[model samples]
Target: MASSLHFLLLFSSLLYNFSIYQAKPFNPTDGLIFHVKKDVSTLQYVTEIHIGTPLLLSKLAVDLGGPFPWFNCAPSSSSRLVNKRSIQCLAAKPKTHQYQGSNKKCHIFTENRITQMAIQGDLVEDIMAINQVTDGSKTGSKSITTVDYNFQFSCAPMLLLNGLASGAKGMLGLGRTQMSLTSQISAQLSSKLQFIICLSSSNGVVLHENGHRSSNFRTKIPDSMIYTPLVNQVETPHEYVINLKSIKISGKKLSLGIEEGKIKLSTIVPYTTMESSIYATFTKAYEQTATSMNITRVSPVAPFGQCFSSRENDGTLVGPKVPAIDLVLQSEMVKWRIHGRNSMVQELLG
Candidate 1:
C-alpha cells in the first residue's frame, strides 16, 4: 500500500509539472506570462490580475477544473463593476438558468436540493494585466513585468462565499470549455489551444501562453520529456482525461485489473480520493513486498499506512529504501519512470 501510495503521489506530481503545447510557428518573442503564488498546504496556485479601466488588483485561483472565469462582486461594489452601464444591464431578477454551453442548471438552496447560487451578471470586455517576473542576471536579480490583454469575463454578483477562503478573490478558469482562458486568448497566439505552467522552487510560478517563450518569459524542458495522448470525456468534454494500463513496483507488475473492469482511465485528477476496495488491494500488495524485504514496520502514520520509524528522535522517517515505480501507459514502449525523491517522500512531524 505504501509503495502504491508513493506511486500515486509521483503520478500527481508529474501531472502537476506536465506542460501541454501545440506545434505551430516559432516566434520565441511573443507570449504572455504570469507569476503564480502557490499555497503549499492546499496546493492551490493563485496569481494577481488587474481588472477594469482604473485597474483593480484581484487575486484569482488558477483552476484547471473550472470551465469559466468569474470574479466575486458585491451588488453595490464599483470595484467589481467595470462601469455603470455594465451594472445596470444585469437582470432585474435572478433567474435559475443554465450557463452557456453547459447542461447543468442553477438551483436555489433548499433542504432537499443542493444549495447553489444563481450566477447573474453582465459579460463585458475588460483590460486584464497579468503579473510576471524576469531574471535580471545570473545572480538572480528579479524584475516585475505586467502583460496586459483584453478579454470578456463574468462578474458574478451573488457568488457563494461560504466555503471559500478569504484569500480566494476569484477563479481563473483553465478548463477545455469554450469560455476558458485558453479559448479566450487563442486568437492572439500561434498555438491556439495550448499553455504551459512551470512551478518554481522559489517564490512564484510561471505561466506561458502557446508554450512559447517571449523576451520576458522563457523555459526549457529536458530532451527526454515524454508525451502522451489525451483522451476525451464524451459527457464532459471540457475535462482533461488520459489513459493508464498498469502500475509496476521495482520491476514487478501488480494486478491493476484495468482490463477486466469498466474503468475507462478517464480522469487523472490530483489529490484523488481512492475507493476503499482499490486502496485495500494496493495496500495488501505493498505490505507483502515490505515483509519480504525483512523491514520492520512501525505504527501507522496519521492519514498514511505502513510507515517505519527513524533511528533518531527527531521524528523523521527513515527506512527500508523504497524501490523504483513505473507507470505503464496504453502507448507502446511508453513507461514513465518514478525514481529519486519522487519515489519516496520523507515527512517530519513536530
Candidate 2:
C-alpha cells in the first residue's frame, strides 16, 4: 500500500511536469548548472554485434569532466571489438500525448530489454578510525583524553541486474515494453571477503567523489587512453537533471548541499548485449518500445565523506581517498531442455 501510494504521487508529479514542458532546441547555456563538482565520471557500456558466438562481453568506458585529468576506468580497449551477445531489448518512443488531456502531440524515448546483466565492484584501504579516549590527570585530578582508531579493507564482486521492465510510452499503438534480466555466478567465487582498513593517528584522509583505485591486473590498463566511443552511448537525448540530496552508507550519513554539487542530466542508451543479429533486433525493439519501459532516476544514498587535516603539520591536506566497490554479475544462460517423460509420452502416442 505504501509503495502504491508513492507510485501514485510520483505519477501525478510527472504528469504535471509533462503538461507544462514545451520542446525546444537544447542550449547548453540554457541548461541550469544545478550541480557542480571538481569532476564527473560518465561510465558508458556498449553492446557489440558478433555472429556464431554464444557469449556476450560487457564493455564499458569512463568519461571525465571537470578539473581532474583523464582516467580510463572503463574495460579493456579490446572489449570494444568483441561482438555483444543479443537479448531482447529495444528503445521506446511514444507516439501520442494521450494522458495530458491532449491529442497525440508529444513523444518520449526510453530503453527496453528482455534480459541484461550488470556487475559492480568496490574497494577501501588505509583509513583512520578515530575513537574517544579518556585518561586521568597525574595530580589525582579527573581528565578526559581522546584516542584514534584504524582499520584496513578491500572487497570485490560481480553484481546481478534483476529488474522487470514495465514503463509506458507515447508512440502509436506500439504500447509499453516489458522484460528483465538475471545474474549467475560460479561456485568458486562464493568465498567470504575480509575487509581491512589500515589506520594510524599520524595520517589524515580526504574522501570525495573524484578519487579512484588502481587496476589489479596489468592487462586492464591501457598504454594510452582510448577516446570515448562514437556510438552506443548510454546518455539519453532528453535533458533531465537530478541531484542527490542525501546519502548513507553503513551507519554514516551525509547530505548534498548546493556547494557540494549540482546535476545536469542527459539521457543515454547502455549497450548490454553482444550478438550482431540480436543487437539489431533489440535495438530496433527498444527504439520502437521506448514509450513503455520504466526508465527512472534512482538516487543511491550511499555513505561518502570528505575529510582533511586543518593542520599541515599532521598528515592532512592530502588528496581525496578512493574507496573500492565490487559486485559479482553471475552469468545467466537461456537454456531449453526437453523433458524425458513428456518426450517419451509424445513418441509413444505418435
Candidate 3:
C-alpha cells in the first residue's frame, strides 16, 4: 500500500507540471491556437491576420464584407465542442485594356488590397499572382483609365485534432467568431467607385471523437467558387458594367458581389438557425454549392437512410460525414469616385 501511494504522488506531480507547460502559448508556423481545459460542448472565438507585406503601410477600404454565418453547425457524439465562427477576407486588383479597330488588343493591369475580420495577431495571409502581368503595359503611356480586379482568401486547414485521433485525450481549437471586411480607396477616385457588396462563407467543421479511425473520416477542403472575367473591349463606363450573375459552388446558388473593376464571391453559404435541422441544411448546402450553387436540396439521403451502424442497433452511423463547405469570400470597390487625391495614382502597375 505504501509503495502504491508513493507512485500515485509521483504521477500527480508529473501531471501538474505537464498542465503548466500546456498553459503556455503554442506558436506554430502554420497558425495560432486556443487551448481550453474544461469540458465544453461548444466554443466560439475570433482572430484576424493581415494579408500583405509586413512593413508596407497602406489603408484598405471594405467595399463589402461580413461573417460566415455557418460553421460546423452540427453536434458530435464524443466529448468535442461545437464551433460556429464565420470569417471573410477580401482583396481587389485592376486591369487596363484598349480596343483598336477589327483587331482588339487587351492588357490586364491590377493592384491588390486586402481586408478581413479584426483579430489579435500580426500574422498576414501571403498572396502572389499565379499569373504575372508585368509585360502587359508600359510606364507613362497615355492609356485609357480602366482597372481589372483579382480577389484572394485563405482558410487555414484543420488541426487533425488529437481528440479525433486514436488514443485521444482532450481537444482545443480557434475559429472566426465574427468579422468585417472592406476596401480602402485612394482619395481621388473614391467617390466615383460605387459599390454593391456581399460576403458569405459556406464554412463547416470536421470533428473526430469516438476514435472512429477510418482514412475516410478526415477533414476535407471545402468547394470554392469565384467570379471569372472574360476578355472584352471597353470604351465608356457603361460598357464596363458586366451583368451581375450568381456564383455557384458545386451547383447551388451562392452570394455574389459587383463593382467597377471588381467581382467577388462567398466560399460557403450563410447560417440560418430558424431551420429545423442544421445538419440537414448543411448537407443540402454542400451539394448545391458543389453543383455550382444551383441545385435542389437533398437531405436524409445517406447516413440518414442507413441504420447508422452495421452492427449496433443504436441508429447511429459508425463513421462521420463531412461535406465540402464553401470557403469564405469578400468583394468590394467604390461604385463612384470619392473626391480626394487619388493616392491610387501613385500605384504603379508597370
Of the candidates shown, which would achieve the greatest lDDT relative to the real structure? Answer: 1
Candidate 3 Cα outliers beyond 4 Å, as residue runs: 1-64, 67-119, 122-182, 186-267, 270-274, 277-299, 302-350
Using TM-score as the measure, name the better of candidate 1 and candidate 2. 1
Every candidate's lDDT: 0.49, 0.18, 0.20
Model 1 / residue 307 / CA error / Å:
3.1
Worst 10 residues of 2 by lDDT: 2-11
Give the alpha carbon lDDT tens digit for every residue of 1-350 in model 3: 00000000000000101111212221111111111121112111122122222221211111112221111111212212111111212221112234356532111121111112222111122221111111111332111111211212222212211122222211111111112111211111222222221111211112112222221211121234234342232422112112223223333334322222222222111111112233345444555433452323333333242111112212213112222222222323211111112100111223
- Residue range 1-350, candidate 2, lDDT tens digits: 00000000000000001012333332211111001111112212111111112222222111111110011122322221111111211122222233344322222222222123222211111222111111112333222121111111111122222222111110001111211000000011221211111111111111111111221111123556322111111352222222222222211222222222213321122211222342344334332332232222222232211121212212112221111111101111211111211111111112
Q: How close is candidate 1 to the true structure, as a TM-score?
A: 0.67
lDDT of 3 at 208: 17
lDDT of 1: 0.49
What's each prediction's TM-score?
0.67, 0.15, 0.17
Error of 1 at 46 (Å): 2.4
